[model samples]
Target: MASTPRSVWHNPVHFLAFGLGSGAAPRAPGTFGTVAAVVIYLLLPVSNPLLYSAILLLSFAVGVWLCGKTARDIGVHDHGGIVWDEFVGYWLTMLMAPPGWFWIVVGFLLFRFFDIIKPWPIRWLDRHVHGGLGIMIDDVLAGLFALVCLQLLAAVI
Candidate 1:
């Protein structure tokens, strides 16, 4: 096992922001990444969908940089461990619906499912794109797909 680094993981907020080093999880880290996001989401004030969306958008916008740096620090390309992408992407997926517990749970699950499965364009983007933007775009597209499915389901019922 690698020795724990000093001054890193010592800061609670940074550690969590890094997804409890879920970014460091050896296998299927993005799934664990989404789980970490779900845990944090449960604690947030999400009574307003728009506000939640704004925050999510901001996270995606900023995620380009943070994910890049974290990947760099970890010496990887689109490393599964760094899940700020998953968090922001999942939040975006949930934004299309009215804020509620049921929808939130479903959104988290759906986003995780799609992200992990990487269907169609999501897979294409992941394979083709590179750099920080690439790190995030596929997940964003996956969230968009999940959002559309959700919106369509809402319309049908």
Candidate 2:
């Protein structure tokens, strides 16, 4: 049930298992976790332009550092169990947009797809960047990708 700390560094399964654990929930843990973060994000009065801007900015800055630190502490790089990038990504994706369940579902799918597919620069960043910021950067790119797609869909629909 538990991975041994001694071998965690060398064990690929342990690292992948730890990272992907976030997706293992009976339901959508990544979506659930992201939505939970949305509640906190919305509670901040970001409905105001200034405050919303701050939350977006601060979350990103903190995300880079915090996610990296957590990854290091866990002895893995961008482990799936660490979904803080999802937290920040969803927070930014939903900002200045409709908060309906439909939008939430759209955001969730887009984020996951982009994260997994890792197109263009997202793939490039994930491969080239190192450390915690590297981990967070790829997700940030995924979030941005989702944001752009969601915005386009909103326009068409």
Candidate 3:
């Protein structure tokens, strides 16, 4: 495991890319980062889909750059400590979700499940892609997969 350096916390880009330091957790940093993302999503006033989408897009754009930069600096591709992708991906998963703690928890589980499993094209993308885009796209697809599952559950329930 690549440890996060103290210098990474001091760098603005590294700070954000690491999901506000949640990614620096000794164990399951990606999971911690996703939890942090959930907290941020709940705090924000995101009833408007357009606004929510805009924020997700902007975050993803910046995440690609910052995540890539941090990975390069650390000399690793998609290091476990670089989890801005988790933040944006979780936000995307909750994009059209119903407003409730229940849904939020469900979304979190689903996103984590898909992200960890990296089924099909998600795994393919993760292996074949490179750089910042590579780091962001897999999580984005995982979020989309979770979104679909969440939507299906919502309809059924």
Candidate 4:
């Protein structure tokens, strides 16, 4: 693993891309980042799908630039500590989710599972893609996978 420099905290781009320092955790930084996302999602008033989707899209756009800049500064591609992708991915997963802590918890678990497991095309993309898009794409796909599952579960229940 590449060591994140102190300078990372100083750079605004790096700081945000690193999930406001949650990504700096020595263990499971991605998971920590996702937890941070969950907290952020809970804090926001997202009763409207259009607003939520717009925010998600904007985050993703900014994330691509920020993640790319941070990875360049850290001299690594998709550094484990660069977890802006996870933040955006989790938010995307929660889109249109039914109202409840139970669903949120389920989304978190499912997103993490798919992200960590990287099934099929997810793994392929992670291996083949490069740069900021690479870092964000796999997680986006994982989020989509989790979203599908959550929607199915919601329907079943």
> On a 0 to 1 TM-score scale, where does candidate 4 land against the true structure?
0.97
Worst 10 residues of 3 by lDDT: 1-10
TM-score of predicted structure 2: 0.75
What's the number of clashes in each of the models? 1, 4, 0, 0
TM-score of each: 0.79, 0.75, 0.97, 0.97
RMSD per model, one decimal:
3.3, 5.9, 0.8, 0.9
Where does candidate 4 stray beyond 4 Å? none
RMSD of 3: 0.8
**Candidate 3 vs candidate 4: which has greater lDDT?**
3
For candidate 2, the 10 contiguous residues with the lowest summed lDDT are 15-24
Cα deviation in Å at residue 83, candidate 4?
0.8
Query: Which prediction has more favorable TM-score, 1 or 4?
Result: 4
Model 4 steric clash pairs: none
- How many clashes does the backbone of model 1 have? 1
Which ranking of candidates, highest lDDT first? 3, 4, 1, 2
Candidate 3 structure quality by residue, lDDT tens digits, 1-157: 6888675679988888889999999999999999999999987657989988999999999999999998888788998988899998899999979989999999999999999999999999999999999999999999999999999999999
How far out, in Å, is residue 81 in model 3?
A: 0.6
